[model samples]
Target: MDATQHDADERFRGEVREWLEQNLTGRFAELRGRGGSGREHEDFEARLEWNRHMAAAGWTCVAWPVEHGGRGLSIAQQVIFHEEYARADAPARVNHLGEELLGPTLIAHGTAEQRARFLPPIVAVEELWCQGYSEPGAGSDLAAVSTRAQRVGDEWSITGQKVWTSLAQQADWCFVIARTEASSSRHRGLSYLLVPMDQPGVEVRPILQLTATSEFNEVFFDDARTDAALIVGGEGNGFKIAMATLGFERGVSTLAQQIAFRRELDAVIDSATRNGAIDDAVIRDRLVRARMTLEVIRQHALRTLGGEQGDGASVTKLLWSNWHRSLGELAMDVNGPASLLVGEEYALDDLQALFLFSRSDTIYGGSDEIQRNIIAERVLGLPREARP
Candidate 1:
């Protein structure tokens, strides 16, 4: 906020920009713009290598405290790093679920032993993580999760299914919220356990999407086990810890995501110009709206960073998800009739994949209806939605 702080922020931004420019070269040069939302399958090994490289360079968990194997970057510095990373077209991070979501949650609520054992692997990108929150019946309504975990001696054996798990096949661990108290219901009886995924008891089945990609999976835990001490917060307090993790989900990385969206929009604009779709007043107006909406999204994201994360997270999810879904539609319209066709075996082009994948934007993370309810109840002090 002060001039000295402003100068330091500029210097940090410069350092981030220089580092990306210098490192994103040679074999890594081709990896730019690879692996994101729908395109997570692209350059899988390459991106993993890149993530490890970042970890080695102390760029992986920039916001974590220095004692926790991080650079201890301030919020502004973290934003700058992410913005520069996106501006450089760096590969989508392979350890985002670990660094951004789980790491912060651990720092906030995990035991010191948990932090010591887990934070290092995450900082080094040695272990990847996937969230185990959604289930067949409880996607947005997290309180209804039925994945059960029973404590047996020094271990907790989990048994249930989780749907819509992103990158589960690639993840080494999953932070699961299971029903620990069978007699309790809703948000009351859940326990958050960190379960390993490499064991024989755990099964990950890829869920193929309309885009012909399988980034999401159905993960089934049949007596999958974790250490009894791996539970975050405490038993029956998982709902609180899970909510904290969700708050971290809407962190500084959203700024980088917006920059990537800007790149996508630029490509769409270039395509529309090449195809002379820009001549259509309607199409051109929509493109302009897309640009303006992206700016608004960035502003809202920045503003929300300084506020209460839970309430702001709902508004942030609503704003970006709907904007992105519309951007996908706009991409299709820009391509005109050619957007309908696919290559042999239904192979999708960038715009085609973008369009199809963005269809789930409003559905995943949190749905439009769910977000509105959160905004109404939590942000506006409204009555809770009546439950059945």
Candidate 2:
């Protein structure tokens, strides 16, 4: 970039850093580094308040168009914002599913009325959202979803179960992909419906995890309803809209995620040094390799940030998920036998929690197997796998 652009980015970075430094004190001071991934239950109400605090200052949805209540930040500025947010060890955002995923989908595919109704609440942090894509039979094979929604007069009546829904219990709405045509199968005749979660027919049951937390949930919709006009991109267009949302899912925040991973890696190294595990030649080698792989992940992410969502995204997913899971394993080895035990009432230390939660890294956000299939068939132009 030119010197002018560099100076501009530096100025934006200063603004983000200064704001975070000032706002992350007083009542929010104790929230640094709290609530993320496997630990979403940590002071959730406090984190929600912090998220709203950022929104009121116009810090949320930095990359969205200015007409949509965002700053319309350039990609570089967005990167700077996320980096500074992570540097400050900011609490995990409470509305990422809304701000990062659904909000963009609405802007891309929703009717103007839908965007008018939803975008403001998301920008204001007055509403939270959860994805409703995966189901009992449709984890990675998303097109195999059996959840069904039927048009009834002015509304759509939805009935089905969604599994592995993150923060469903806390969400005010869900962007659901359900089969809207009874005779349809696979990718056809599906619709993306924005269903409110507080209605009588919806139930959210938290699924406890190995981390002793319920970051994930099973949501049952017994004739849960949404307005007929709430369908995004029209009926029978859910697959395209859902895929776009998934592409957004793998977008800009990944840079911040890698920074968090780096923090975890640093903590592991510190533990190894204090416990003398660093003396082990094997442990030292693994630590070096982990750092190198992280750099690879970061470079690949930057290269593909604004590019097409081809195999680049899948390749990045495979590289980072495997590397992260490996880092967790290395953390366990560094901790030695201590990793095998838990605290009173089964409390887990940081490394132990990392290892346990990282086990699912390769499985969620589309599994490693599914990502490899996308690369093999879509990128390599290989023969399609046989499907029954």
Candidate 3:
């Protein structure tokens, strides 16, 4: 962008910074830095309130179109807002699936009526959402989804399971991909249906992790139904719509994620210094390398946000996932032998939680193996991987 645009963005950044500083006070001040990936269980009700506060202030969904209850921020402005939010240590947002992923997908692909129905709740933070994509068998191979949805008159009955569904128990709705056509396999015959979570046919069972937290859940649908008209992008086009959602998953918010990682890295460095681990040449070198890699990741994220996608999201997913997982390992190493021990009732420290949770970074959001295949085949013009 030109200098004039850059200056305007800087002004916008200052405005965002000022607003956060002014509003993130009193009750909201206590919520700063609470409720993140492994810590989603922290101050959740308060975070929900904070999220609604943002919605009321027109702070949520800043990048969405104005007609859709968003500020219609430019890319530069959106980046500025997120950067300021991270810098201020704002509470982690609870409605990301709606505001970021599902909202954009609807705007891009939904019919006029669908957008009118869904976008308002998302913008108002009145309804929460979860992705009904990964099943026990599906995981990263999205094409392998076996969730079945059959049309019955004006409604579609969906029956299947989704594992590792983030905040499934709390969501009022879920965007589900289920097989609507029989005698079809892989990516075909799939339909993206918006199913309600409050109905009798739906169930959620929290999955406790090594960290003793259950932010992820196993969601089951037993003849759960949504209106046939609720389908986004039409039947047999679920795969394409899902891919578009994944693209938004790796959008401008990545820059804010890196800022969070930087905070974690700084804490690890402080721990290393306190425990005399910094004196070791190996640990020190690794710390320096980590810092440099983070900068490179930030630069790549900025470029990807401004330019053509062109396999950028896959590359980014690989970079940050591996970098963050390594940071968790470094935290453990810095903590020395004390890291292995647990407090009363197996209570883990922050570093321990970081280490355990980071283990799944490579596994979720399209695994490292899947990302590499995309880069190889799509970016390099290599032959596609043979499917069994």
Candidate 4:
């Protein structure tokens, strides 16, 4: 807040802009949907390539300390990095689970050996991880996680199922939450494990999103084995561990995502203008609304990160989720039937793809209703709604 801090923040922002301007050129601009960004998305190979590029550039896990293969960034520097990434229209880093979730948890709680063994490879993009939360029966009720892991002397035997695991099939590892001691209790009996996701006794059943191709899946554990040393935190601390990680997830996820949304908004405006659809007053009004929403989302994100906490601005996530859905709908409406087309036509011409992905943003992280409940109860001091 002092003059030195202000100067450092400005210098960091300027450095980030310079770095992106230097490295993010050529086809990457096309990748970020610059020629057009909302409907355009990278394929799996392009995504992995982008992650490697960012990782090598020391930009993958920008929040980590330098010794752990991060850039040793200040919070302001982190914001600057994201802003410049957005400004350059870079693709979202595909190693989000590694760079965001696993790395932070390791920083907070992992042992020296665990830190040394697990984090750097992730930072370097050698490893990819997925969240093994959200079981078939446990969606927002995270405490009801029934994936069981039993102690077998030196090793642990895991059995149960996790549904809606993002990138589960392709991930090298998973940060899994399971019920370890059921003394027949739910929340009090859980534990977290870092498991090799591709091992035997693991089944990955692809779950289709609205677009059709599977982006997530149900992962089953039939006597899946993991080492006892893989236990994250002490036993029965899984809920606490997972919740603590969600705080980091909410803010960081919003930062990365808001940038994406603003890009989408800009893309929408440009697409509308280019297509001659901006002549419609409805389209103009909608663009105006989108601009206002983007501003609010950005301000809310800053406030949430600035320490005014309440379920850590789950509302921000929920708002953007809904806002994006509307954006997709607007794109379709503005473009008429042509929005149904999906391809690599430069920028984000994959309107069909954006429309599809938008449908699920509300479901991931947490659903809109659940976020609203959290905001009401925790932020507004409201009473719970009883279900029949």
Cα lDDT tens digits for candidate 1, 165-186: 9999999999999999989899
| Better-scoring candidate (lDDT), 3 or 4 | 3
> What TM-score number comes out for model 1?
0.98
Q: How many residue pairs clash in each candidate?
A: 0, 0, 0, 4
TM-score-best of 1 and 4: 1
Q: Which 10-residue window in model 2 sums to the lowest lDDT? A: 303-312
- TM-score per model over all chains: 0.98, 0.98, 0.98, 0.88
For model 1, give the 10-residue run with minimal summed lDDT: 303-312
RMSD of each: 1.1, 1.0, 1.2, 3.4
In order, candidate lDDTs are 0.92, 0.92, 0.92, 0.77
* Candidate 4 residue lDDT tens string, 50-121: 678877877778778888878787766777777777767666667777877788888888888889999978
Off by over 4 Å in 3: 306-310
Candidate 2, residue 43: the lDDT equals: 94
Give the local distance difference test score of model 4: 0.77
